[model samples]
Target: MDQCITEVKPIKGFYKLSMKQRMGFGAGDLAQNLIYQTVSMYLLIFYTNVYGISAASAGIMFLIVRIVDVIWDPVVGAFVDKNSPRMGKYRSYLLLGGIPLTGFAILCFWNGFSGSLTYAYITYIGLSMLYTLVNVPYGALNASLTRDTDEVTKLTSTRMFMANIGGLAVGYGVPLVVKYFSPDGKINSKDSAEAWFVTMLIYALVGLVLLFFCFSQTKERVIMDEKDTENVKVSDLWQEFKHNRPLRILAFFFITAFSMMAIGNSAGSYYMIYNVNAPDMLPYFMALGSIPAFIFMPLIPAIKRAIGKKQMFYVFLGIAILGMIMLYVISTNEALKGNTWLVLSAQFIKSTGVIVATGYMWALVPEVISYGEYKTGKRISGIVNALTGIFYKAGMALGGIVPGLVLAYVAFDKDNVATQSDMAEKGILWLVAVIPAILLLLAMYVISKYELDDATIDKINREIESRVNY
Candidate 1:
């Protein structure tokens, strides 16, 4: 073991990152979320209401695509680990995969093949698969950068902050842009296909630019040696999962946290358009979902220092539940529903908790990776990230499935734009509030099972580095 460890060298300045590198590293996530958040939040609505697809069909398609991800993620993970492309091991995909990702993303919103499930299947599946190619590598890139727990924490905060900027842009900007281009000046109108296409095209182009920037700015300093790379296998993904307890805990947490966020996000449009009876307020409400990240995310390092990690999760998760309860109460009450201030206030409160809880989870990824390396004596960031990706995508699948199923079950009439049935409105409300609240509760429980605290992970990282140095 000592002889094996002696072959590798400790990375110099592993914990230090310049602000430019941090910001540039973050831009990749920002770019991804700009396109992905739009799909997560609006694609279902677009499919059922505007693009002329059945809710049930779209729901099944979502599940199928994510199931595909379960298989594809491991393949991508193993492939990425084995190959070191000329551009960079992980960064190459940022451009290679990103270009196609942008094109498919734009095509997903186009209505040229109106009401065609084949068109939806072709474009949506393409977008999802290409996304994996980029995402798995991007996730691995985080652990590749450094092993310092504090640096990873700070890096994660910046990444989440930038990611939410994309979320904010998608949440608020998409609607506003689509509305501006719409002939009727309304996003919900069936005739707004042209508007959706144009908006997505611009967003996709911008996302490609940011991805290129991310590729240029980031470097991978702490990575597996070529010999270690040669040993990586797809089956190692499961092998690591079996032995890595923290990864399991974190993976489950991903499922629950992402499910909560996804369900709430998917339900936002219906909540604003139907429950609040204020389409104009949708942008504000959606934008507020991400805006809290700007204020709270930067304070994460301090917040963790003060409260400790688990307590932070407990506090924020509780706040999220409270906000959801408030939203449910206000929306159900006819008089209170019309008051946009109250609704927006509830949104801000809910988002603060959701954003902070979920945002901080990314920081835990490196800890788990370090833990895995400490135990297994192998650093396979790709496989570990692939496992997390599977679970998060599983969570996202629920986000897609639940809303579509609820809309179908409630018998939502796409034709009735003026007002949905009472049952449908209640279902949308449940999706926005009650469902997410339950998921938040589950998330809190799952996070509690995560055993690695900063002190523990810091020790593990040092031990791992010592081995490499000796």
Candidate 2:
């Protein structure tokens, strides 16, 4: 085994990861999800319910923050690539960027200050920027960890598994924790703001702890070539954008898939509160979304091996759309009103498809990175990650903007104790079901355009290996 390890074909540089090393690489993702999921799942609710911001104002804020991401993500990516810190280029940011990320995330949910809009702008924008600071490097760190294709796949699966651990914690635990802190077990009641503050504070602190663990576990192995580092320019990003067709297809697929998940997840709080009239069930519904990750995530590699990646995408995405259609029809049907079991069942089914399909997409990033290196003799890992970061952030923006705008247009009232108006209920239903259904359909189309299959990536890796041997 040791001889085989030493005798394996080499690229410009090579790194081998033990199981412990691979699991450590994935710990970073767990830390990341804790912070990111806080914003993704709870921020909208915090805005409307706790801080008392109008949905329209929150929507505009979301769009502005995403636009700000346009400038910020590339800078973080490039900064990591150009400068190497003592701890390592990418992992250093976990401590530097993550501590503040934790603080800002907590602040975003705080209601101590009366300046809702100012608090919203400061905390949210800070959270977004700090998140990019940590996230971009973490992504770059993944590429730097190893060059082995199969190893990266295992690493991605492990990362996603740990990531879902964070997601599950946030999804399943937050509401229960919040309710415990609420004045009398009512999250939508007058004391809900206090509950939110308490819950976010705890989640943030726990997230910071995990960030430290991630920092302790991972290290950079396949460092970029120094001469190539000297030639690194942001303009090189555009060159890849122009020549890398698979990257473009992947970028669009990221947008569509993320948009689909975001739109659906964002609207979940509203759907349970208004349309279903069982606000307590929101956590269960949200938990349902992450549960599939546990079930299907472990099966991804085997599934991909059996059916192929492209076919796997077509299969899961089609199932996702069908689940959404079921949700829409059931939610909108008068006969199904008050049927909590039926509604939750549909959500569980819808999420099964969404979670597995989306979770597996992260594995493709390294493949595209390798493909770029094979084609151009340059491996700008930062640039590829930055581009995909933009699309994923865009999806998050749509998640924030669309539901807020739709609810605002339909006149959703945050202050109301009773159910929302009929029109608002319809809007929530559409947000949960129809809109995501459309986005999933588009995702199927975009993923179909992906040209790099396993065979192609394997071929590229072999060619690169052959060249290095001579």
Candidate 3:
């Protein structure tokens, strides 16, 4: 292997990016978006409706899976950075981890398992572990692609755009597809569970194809020095976490962002079915949650340039908060009744804010990656990703746990295929309206503290390269 040359050049206003790099990096996100959306949006409903698992049990599984992520993420991160794999450090996992992920995901939806608690545990836990292996490496791959701030921004935008494309497909298509498999209009325990089986098989196969595309399209460049293959230690993990300020900021942001999205996404089915009295319309409304990403994600880099990242955060997060408020008010009001349009409108507004804000946040990881290298002459992309991966999973865990607990506490009865009680209705509303709104507000505060803008990051990159070459 040839020694890679490293340097930094400054840019003004928007970061410049070539279309190939942008599209290449974006492909990975599309795959991840599908994988994540399947879990976030559809998995819970599958567990309750098809698998015959109680909501509370499913919620516990969600939490357990996250706990498993905490243990697994660092290991994957450390292992990737240390071993120089033949297919490239991160890209190999797309196929390696993805194969099992696809298989497990399909199995999770399989109705032939006789619906045991133990079977659910095995499939869900294995799938979650495989997802972590793929996800942590993919995250590190982003930072490994380039050091140019502007290129990173473009990469982030393009990646997020592709990701939302996957999101839209899952959000919009899954419900309709699930309905297609159902002999009856509604999915319930009595519906032979074949609908979920068929649905999972479709998503898992589609997801596998997308992952292959990601593997084919992307390549890693400007990664860590080959000589830096020192064994990644437990102490090094603590050191990185202790020293990296920007890493801390991104980590906290992930927690809040994932939690907000998770709670809302997880609770969506219940909200539509119970409160809105339109079980059939859940996909359309849930699709609204991701639809804005298609419209707003392409505009993110432009939006960041026009408003500055911090101000953009303030504006978009505020928009999301406002949308949450509107949802709370509308869901609470009897005059609105069961108007699907009003609910859809609220979902659109809320998603518009969330889609752009959260989608663009991935761009910040590379900046922090550069910052970590600048501060400590060691560019451990895997460890940086691992650190942040902890927070992302943490947020997702909270999202899953909170809703699972809430529904369980309210005594949510999945067997009642027609109508739910007032308590269950309140629980669903809280997940959709109150809980997510609070998390978004907290996200705003955490993101406010994110200090690295374009100038500082550019300066840090130059300073680090200079220090290394000198």
Give each model's whole-structure lDDT. 0.91, 0.81, 0.82
Query: What is the overall TM-score of model 3 with all chains considered together?
Result: 0.94
Query: Which 10 successive residues of model 2 have the least lDDT summed?
Result: 4-13
Cα lDDT of model 1 by residue, 1-470, tens digit: 45544545535525588899999999999999988999999999888888999888998899999999999999998989888999988999999999999999999999999899999999999999999999999999999888877788899999999999999999999999999999988777688999999999999999999999999999988887778778799999999999998999999999999889889999999889988889999999999999999999999999999999999999999999999999999988877877889999999999999999999999888888888889988888888888999999999999889888999999988776668998999999999999999999998888888778878888888788877631
Q: Return the TM-score for each candidate structure.
A: 0.97, 0.94, 0.94
Top candidate when judged by lDDT against the true structure: 1
In candidate 3 the C-alpha lDDT for residue 89 amounts to: 87
For model 2, residues 28-117, the per-residue Cα lDDT tens digits are: 787778778767877776678667788888888998999999887777666777777888878999899999898898888778874368
Candidate 3 C-alpha lDDT tens digits along 164-237: 88888888887787778788856555584788777777777777787787788677765766677566654566
Lowest-scoring 10 consecutive residues by lDDT in candidate 3?
Answer: 9-18
Please give the lDDT score at residue 217 for candidate 2: 82
Per lDDT, what order, best first?
1, 3, 2
The alpha-carbon lDDT assigned to residue 97 of candidate 3 equals: 92
| Per-candidate total of colliding backbone pairs | 0, 0, 1
The residue ranges of model 3 lying beyond 4 angstroms of the native Cα positions read 1-17, 467-470
